[model samples]
Target: MAQGSSSPGDDAGNLDKTFREWQDDGSSEVATLGGVYGGANGVNHMVLNVRDMEKSHDFWTRVMRLEHCGTQGGPGQPRFLRFYRSHGHTHHDIALSPAKDPDSLPIPTGPLQTPGLNHFAWTYPDLETWKQQVRHVVDTGYPIQFRMEHGMSQSLYVRDPDGTVVEMMYEFPEERWNENIEAALEYRRVLDIDNDPDYFDPKPEDMPLFDENGLAEAS
Candidate 1:
């Protein structure tokens, strides 16, 4: 499509090295920072339309290290549904439901480029927990498709059984990015994750923030 108008899940493979800025399409509309109205509280859960519930259950638990709460319907039942949770927050963070017609769709072989759910991220409650999940993914030979140092947070992106992008990330202390969230959003550093021996550790120094004019400055 057009530069700066691409979705985050665009099929383009070289975004890691690309420097991007929002391109206005001549629309002057804007939304309130938080919201003029309260809006929905937050994304409580997501139910994915998956081809195989068992396979999806395996991958979701593998990447998220979530608790497989339970399953619903089976045997004489007409559908299969499974639920998973990360505790601390709510009863379930993700669930799986059978797709409308498994054979009608061509299974995606790469990152999703189509119009749909872009991606959903789950920020681990603690750093070690997040690293543990990353290590497990590497150890088990699950493909770690993308890695990014996003200033305030570092993330690893992996595809699930249905080729949906799921990001596992952990944020640094709020002090690191609260000062210049605008700069934080602009920061993008793609690192050689597996090659770097200490990739799981917090960056030695705080990430650089910038002034309103985009000049590098302290956090």
Candidate 2:
């Protein structure tokens, strides 16, 4: 009998034969260009469920440095808080919803034994912007768990009121994106900028080759 076979003559009995049938079906396509051909433009917005809407709103707008755009619902009812005042003109970049259960735990309610959304990252345009972010967090007295150079980017992690991790990152120079791609595919290892002292403040010569046309030119 086949290892996985329910019956001796069943096609599903042989794993190898079942795999071959899937490959020969010719119902799938792979992109030779190796990128999202028609993917989403970017992350539009995110919603977080919290025990106290007022507290979450204050943390997001003041501590996290986002703008309080507008909101729906009313006090003592199901309230929603919106933040987009400074970030962009979008209706809301991030929003908060108060937990319906008044007695729900203030901390994350997800399973403690299993891995879940470790964190979500937001990127800044350049080092200066990132530095400004650092200043804001410091001034607000928001807790900073860690700050480090992650090879391809510099990052700071902060915990919100509900103990959710939010990562603030500044991407490395775009000219080096090709180098990042090559390193990721070939060595399958993250570039550790922390190991290099100069990574903190690069010189002109250390800059990666970049043309206005973009990666194709640098490559």
Candidate 3:
């Protein structure tokens, strides 16, 4: 299905302006700034630090239904465990390393409004099932951060046990995504910034705002 356009106040306008300005300058900086050379590969996986490897592993495996990919280091190497969705490939979708102390890492003890690595998103096949998954998580009493209509994707955000944010999304159809890509390029041209705001900006209400549970609310 066609992904919806971003809301009026969304950063798409700014991005299109920025992209246009960059192209006019004939500067190679935009490519480097945007990491365009790396191409658009979906997320490989995310690595997280946890207080206890065994406890984290058990929670992921039993509660989240992820398969244990195995651990690194037999005895002293720094115990790290990998886990993947039973149906996922790529070694793992998430990895956990034991933290010396949980308190050492800053967990979100406040509202979702606080910044930093809002969430990592996984793509789904369609929007209907995606919404169902959101409903399921809500019914199960899991916090929903927000739901968002990204103009390129429809997404849902939630938090994991350690306050790591997670997202599930369905990319817009190719044609629609391409249109947004073109618009984003235009935005980049008009604005002199090195990269698009959609990709950077640590604020939650930027283009994508999340609900109380931290889910990206649908625009």
Question: What order do candidates take by lDDT, descending?
Answer: 1, 2, 3
For model 2, residues 57-125, the per-residue Cα lDDT tens digits are: 788878777877777776667565544543664677777777678476556534334466667888887
Which regions of candidate 2 fall more than 4 Å away from where they truly are?
1-34, 78-81, 106-115, 182-219
Return the TM-score for candidate 1, rounded to 2 decimals: 0.74
Residue 115 lDDT in candidate 2: 67
- In terms of TM-score, how similar is model 3 to the real structure? 0.56
- TM-scores, one per candidate: 0.74, 0.64, 0.56
Off by over 4 Å in 3: 1-36, 39-42, 52-64, 74-77, 86-88, 109-116, 182-219
Error of 2 at 218 (Å): 16
Candidate 1: clashing pairs of residues = none
lDDT of 3 by residue, 141-184 (tens): 66666655564565666677787777766565554435346442
For all the candidates, what are their Cα RMSDs to the real structure? 10.9, 11.4, 14.1
lDDT of all predictions: 0.69, 0.60, 0.55
Candidates 1 and 3 compared: the better one by TM-score is: 1
